[model samples]
Target: MTVEYWRAKIWGLLHDPVLKALHNNSGRGKNSFYKQLEVMKPWVETGKTPDQSGGKVLENILLADYIASASDRSAIGSVTASINYAPGKNREKGLEITHLLSGARQEWKINSHDELIKGKRKDYLVQKEQKELLAKVPKELQDPSIKDDIKKIKQLYWWLWRCLPQATCDLFKDNSLMLMPAETRIPDASIWSHVSMTSALAGALAGYDLTAAQIQRWQGNDELSHPYLAVFSFSPVQELIKSSRKMRDFWAGSWLLHYLSAKVCWQLANQY
Candidate 1:
């Protein structure tokens, strides 16, 4: 609201038809279970190639392998991809979204690395993880061109991230983070709520020096935010639980706004 740049992003995410569908189908399954996924309506951007965008994370290993072995760029010509641009004054919304999204992603990655991949020893663990990842990578990666060249993959991965706005991206490293305790229970999915969960906190940090009171109080539904405090055995999760919130007010406001805004963005993204 403070920045005019987010106007299009906010409006687009809030009004996207995909979000309408998700909003319409909040609780449909057994246990009256709800859908937490907020789809975003995508307004396709032109002039950028998919390769220029973020490489497909799920499919990156294979894609990178093929791209590397290719005699030329033609081999990767039809590969599906998306380019990410960094956010800044020129792209307030992008900055706002990137801040929160990437920050959360970093947490997820860090948690994943610590719990599943490496357990917080980035320099130490990254090399080991990459080696293991190399084993799972398909034969194409065996190519001398691509093998052991994680730097290229990291570069492309970051390139995809470029599409996101920068203001938001910085939230990963900011002080205004949310801290909370929650629990969730659904069929085959029983877990605790997130810690200071919400991308708004990140967004606020990106936009300006937002205070705690700016975000409205959260009304949890299975849809937007979760409700519970059951913890899990994931190795790094306990560490997250121990993680402290540097600022409480910022945490609350940021988490709240981030949730609502992402709801719109996710819906809009799904439409395309």
Candidate 2:
């Protein structure tokens, strides 16, 4: 497949909720899904691999998958009921998800996260948005001469991390639930947090300067001998709510804490 094809395929995979739901049953698979996309950054941006052999590209992809799987063991026991259902089985009855804006339960389909955020309420109907975003993959792969459009790819990446969250928050009735979950397995973490951490992890891996051969040798090993790093941040909210006199005060304190936390995240994002 051409680089454009991989770009489109990665983009389509991330935006397709059905595909994510299908592949992300286990935490390792979910992390690997995103990690592989991150590892493809060089190909996605330059339309070329590290060398002429084309072997390094495959090595990088495998390395990313391996690292992601080995790094997280917390989700091994968190399998859900949806894992057993076949693809489109839930779609036949119409899948229901908590509406990000209203928190009201609704039957819907998310083909593209960007489109869903921009579309009206009626646009969410499963039959109305039946087109699969992955339909363009074959066409992209067939056209090897297609020019690399880095700007558009970057925009899609930006929309995934930035615009989608803003739009969701703007439409949400409750500030307490403004952020979207990164994955169903980890409901407390926001999608922004996951993406930011993935970016950071990818950056650290790049700086480590490990060769393809070394990564291949290390694959499937159960040791945490790799340079992977996880950073955690904590914000104490008890003090913020300690002075609350009423229920409204408690809500206000919580909103303030969320707002401040978001500000810190945005600052960190800007620094990079």
Candidate 3:
């Protein structure tokens, strides 16, 4: 077979799992925010703490609220949340995610006055959304602390939506990627850490450039790279990482060597 043919086959192998995952889910589908929370209700009702789930339920809550409030007509959006650290040099500074909520709006190109007004708007929306979402939580699960935790998630989603400017919105509308600052609250060995590490590893494999031929080719072949496309949607990590060798990296960074290299490392780590 030709090199191009092999590349195409490899690419297909790399992306099939991600494609299936993304295609099979949606915000309003069985995987909807309310649906995910419903699945978690039993646990919360049984008095399971967030740490007991290793904060996984909390992660789901965060993702759910984010989709409900910020995903804009689709379960998928250009909400790029990942970690960044210096490559090769200054690695000891550690990976830092963007912490942007309390910062000034000038960097986001939004006027302070407008941001203040928008912040209030978002706050109102959060209040309304929080109450509605919490209402969906079973009364059995509505302990004071659980209610408080969901409220905090509401605030977090609002802060995230507010920090993102119209330009970023437009960019997503145009199906372009927009990198946001890192968040500080993500903990060690958390799901966020896996996400961050996956993303960082993807970037490293791509040399932090998206314009590479392989990525560009994959972008053309698979519409998932750009969130503006109608076919593109968010897939759960559980689905994305399922019984697959290269799916996560392919979905995370398109076509890159890390997709294969990470597969090797994953297998090696699991062997023990």
Query: Which candidate gets the maximum lDDT versus the true structure?
Result: 2
What digit string (tens of lDDT, one per residue) describes model 3 on residues 1-272?
A: 12222211112111111111111122111111221233234333544322233332222222322332222222324544432222223323333333234433321211222332333433432332234433433454334343325444333333322332232334234211132221212311212222233322222232312232332234334322111112323345456545357767646654334466677668754662
When superposed on Cα atoms, how far off is each prediction in RMSD?
Answer: 24.4, 10.3, 22.1
RMSD (CA, Å), candidate 2 to true, equals 10.3
Candidate models: Cα lDDT each: 0.24, 0.39, 0.29
lDDT of 1 by residue, 149-168 (tens): 44433332232223212221
Candidate 3 lands at a TM-score of 0.24
> Candidate order by lDDT, highest to lowest?
2, 3, 1
- Arranged by TM-score with the best first, the candidates are 2, 3, 1
TM per prediction? 0.16, 0.41, 0.24
Residue 211 displacement (Å), model 1: 50
| Model 3 weakest lDDT span, ten residues long | 15-24
Task: Choose 2 or 3, whichever is better by TM-score.
Answer: 2
